[model samples]
Target: MDDLLSGLRMPERVAPGALFLPGYAASIEREALRGIAAICALAPPHHLLTPGGRRLSVAMTGCGAFGWHSDRAGYRYVSRDPVSGRPWPAMPRSWRDLAREAAERAGYPGFEPQSCLVNRYDTGARMGLHRDCDEDDLTSPVVSVSFGVTAAFLFGGAERHDPVRKLAVESGDVLVWGGPSRLAYHGVAPLPRRTHSLTGPLRWNLTFRRVTHRQGP
Candidate 1:
């Protein structure tokens, strides 16, 4: 797959501090998917309740030291799986290396992500525009890797009412945003009923974040 990524073009700047990397994860897709499956085996994916009591359409799970969670209390990161009551599966080295390399390529170097929120979007599932503010280390970019079916990614400014740009994200694509765009509102549009050779009818996303200011580089 390294040969597959070699012919790709340079990263496209989507905003002041946001870059869209086409097929950035092509080389590691199989390993990443296997890692995600292993993580899910230990910590099953489930829809989380929003602070408003609404249930998210996307099923969520994670790996790494911290996993992003949402409940009646609100969105936050926890060291253990809320369901299994065990530590989230350790983040795979390939995942960490890919995230770090992607962030560095996007101009945010030394991004040591402590949380990797894995979201599974079945057909018709969609995420509302929102900022990732739970993490204290806002300087580190959010490195999002997409696999499986294609979906529309909505990237917006800081405010909820700001204009949004829709981008088609296919399997193996990566999007990194931070710096001025760290607080940008972003979400996934409703996934169309479709199939990918690798993931069948689902779209998988691995979102890497630096959850705290104290974590090492």
Candidate 2:
């Protein structure tokens, strides 16, 4: 596995533990897109309102052992989909394999993500800087895959006031961050209005996480 990954080329270390593998997901783009369609069909994505009652621009859904959710109540992981009132669809094998491989290539081996958050961003949609801390196991890394239009990704330090490093993430790119950078504040800048043959004027982001800490529904 190491040899194969090495042949693919070394990944750029964006931070202490954050590695960026450009075009790492290109080979399986078609399969991953199909899996996204299947998962979305089962649990349609929808914009969620925050605890502050502000609606998020990104529409989202999830699949795996748990689904990340936020609402007027709070943010946490739930075993069932808040929309369908059913268990989130099982994680696609292809998706899981890609995530595990990407994580391992980024230096975090033995990563078993139990949750995959699928987020869809339309033109003008943006995610605010925030830390992903709901998961119990901080030891495991978060693997993110981008599809469709390119966007600027902001990676910052532990404090919100810390300077942020902006990086452009293109389709088929994989990013993994864990260990010291697991709780770093990060977010996506507002997407520019544009169209891509594969996704039109939208971008799809898949975030894989191991939600070892399960909360009651």
Candidate 3:
């Protein structure tokens, strides 16, 4: 949002778009406050409907070229933001830099993310396992950065029958998944009742993706 649009840079962590890495973005972590400030400017995290009317406890917002939204109509992304009926705030330069570095570190090159889904978690908020298939393009990998509170990142295989791998993610951690790992069902388990200095009693997750509404390469 307007309040968070400070143009800052974290030259430490920059990468391509395929390989998944963790804890290599300390500079980005320090600059996260700036990014959060910007996200709050556009769409503050608000519990949204799950199409079935179930209220999600986590506050969800977004930045970049498109923002993700879900309602009774189903899940999708568009140029216009549902909240202000204006376009989602442009992805901050900090985000772009980090994603590029993380992607490159993970082995992918030239990763340009157009959508950044911001998920804010309160003490008890949790997200169930779900595959991110709304993007018309499944070939692109997903790059995510964890901030604030610590939690378990559940990374599952393609089939539900396949067990999940729980990875402990603390602040300033980045995860990248593509190729066979891209379609894996991943989610955040409930945050234990805890608080932090920078993040307070919450968890902030920034997931960057390249979404194609109707077509892709």
Q: TM-score winner among the candidates?
A: 1
Q: Pick the candidate with the highest lDDT.
A: 1
Q: In model 2, what are the clashing residue pairs, if there are any? A: none
Kindly list the per-residue Cα lDDT of model 1 for residues 1-217, writing each as its tens digit. Answer: 7637643445789889999999999989888889889888899999999889999999999998898888899888999998988988998988999999999999998989999999999999999898998888888899999999999999999889999998888899999999999999999999999999999999999999998886452
lDDT tens digits, residue span 76-157, model 3: 8877678788888888887888887777767666778889989998888888998887876676678888888888878787
Name the regions of candidate 3 deviating beyond 4 angstroms.
1-20, 213-217
Deviating ranges (above 4 Å) for candidate 2: 1-10, 213-217
What are the Cα lDDT values of the candidates? 0.92, 0.90, 0.77
Deviation in angstroms for 55 in model 2?
0.2
Regions of candidate 1 where Cα sits further than 4 Å from its true position:
1-10, 215-217
Pick the winner on TM-score between candidates 2 and 3. Answer: 2
TM-score of 3: 0.87
After superposition of all CA atoms, the RMSD between model 1 and the true structure is 3.5
Query: Candidate 2 lDDT, tens digit per residue, 1-217?
Result: 8658434444788888999898999888778888889999999999998999989999999899899899999999999998989999999888899999999998888888899999999999999999999988888999999998889989998899989998778789899999889999999999989887888998999999998843312
TM-score of each: 0.94, 0.92, 0.87
